[model samples]
Target: MFDVKTIGIIHTPYQQKFGVPRQPNLVPLGTGELHLIAPFNHPDCVRGLEQFSHLWLLFMFNHTAHQGWQNMVRPPRLGGNEKMGIFATRSTFRPNPIGLSAVELHDIVIQDNCTILKLGSVDLVDKTPIIDIKPYLPYSDSYPLAKASYASEKPAIMLTILFSELADQQLLLKPQLKDLIQQVIAQDPRPAYKKKSLSTQEFGITLQNANIRFKVEDDIATILSVE
Candidate 1:
């Protein structure tokens, strides 16, 4: 048997799984702080981390706990296309319940023995337990000719933003709303195989409890209504 321990807790904006991006890179602007807990705070443990542009975060799915793991999981990209083994997918439910993500490292200021991991491109849920960290060596991580068996090719995509004509007189230019909308749409919510018909259809994501619905027309996505 192998023994394991949590290095620290990762802090994220999401308290629940309802709206978080499926992966970290998908939320390129999300902010997070890795609250380095005691014991793992030993400076030697995090030595030389500042030299890397990005680091691989190894964390645990403390919220998505599973008992007697399943062998297959349906990836959202496939829109329930086919079943693949747990090992082949980054599903939260697996025999080990571990996760890995390459996140941009914004800063690494050390306080006493603790290292404050300031980061960008984070999409983890609040208080997620971290197991380990490793530098992402570009020489080995990037492969220009690599093949993606599931979703390799990038497709032509477009989006729009139209605010409600009835928007609050004093809230028409709220920065948070724009930030939220940009964050939500950049994720490309539509299923991979689905046709790009959002040009005239309405769709939305929950923002600050309001359903920020909109319709994409031509190249402009109009925020038809907010409720």
Candidate 2:
């Protein structure tokens, strides 16, 4: 049997998965930190890691564990109208409930007796277990001619957002939080099957200790409140 150990845990503003951006770096304003566990928190462990601007994070989908996977998955980018082989899509329900994300390495610091690595544009859930961290090599990782069948082009923002008075007040208290919300909503986090449907249902997303409610209508998303 193979043994895998978690070397760290990720801390982020995202308290749940309902509103998480589907891909890493998609929400450039979102940020997080990786707190290294004992034995792995030593400075020597990351001696030359600071030279790289980005890193690859291998993490576990702890919440999705025990759910079986299928050979085919419906991709959200395809509007859930088509099926692709499991290997072609980044589906959390996999043979192994693990995820890989490329995130910007902002800095390494110590606070409150803990060593942490500050990350930017991270698409992981709060408290996600990190299995490994590796420097990202742009020379080999990037392909100028790489082609995707249906996802070749970046998705465009299709909706306009309006914040309620309560949300505006919350933004004044925490201005940095506004960018995260704007970018996430612009991407439209609804499921592929519900993208074209319309309803009066209010959707709520939790960020840090604040809750945000909004509704979508005719390609417009209006923030109802922030509490």
Specify the highest-TM-score model's number.
Answer: 2
Best by lDDT: 2
User: What TM-score number comes out for model 1?
Assistant: 0.74
Model 1 steric clash total: 4
* Each candidate structure's count of clashing pairs: 4, 0
lDDT by residue (137-227, candidate 2, tens digit) is 9999888799988888878886688888878876887777777788888888888766767765568898776788999888888888877
Tens digits of per-residue lDDT for model 1 on 1-227? 88878888887755555546776666555667887778877777778888888988999887787554788987766666788888877777888788888789888768766777888767677788999888999999999899887867642233554566764432466666566656656555555443345445656655545666666556565666655
Off by over 4 Å in 1: 112-114, 154-177, 185-227
**Poorest 10 consecutive residues by lDDT, candidate 2:** 193-202
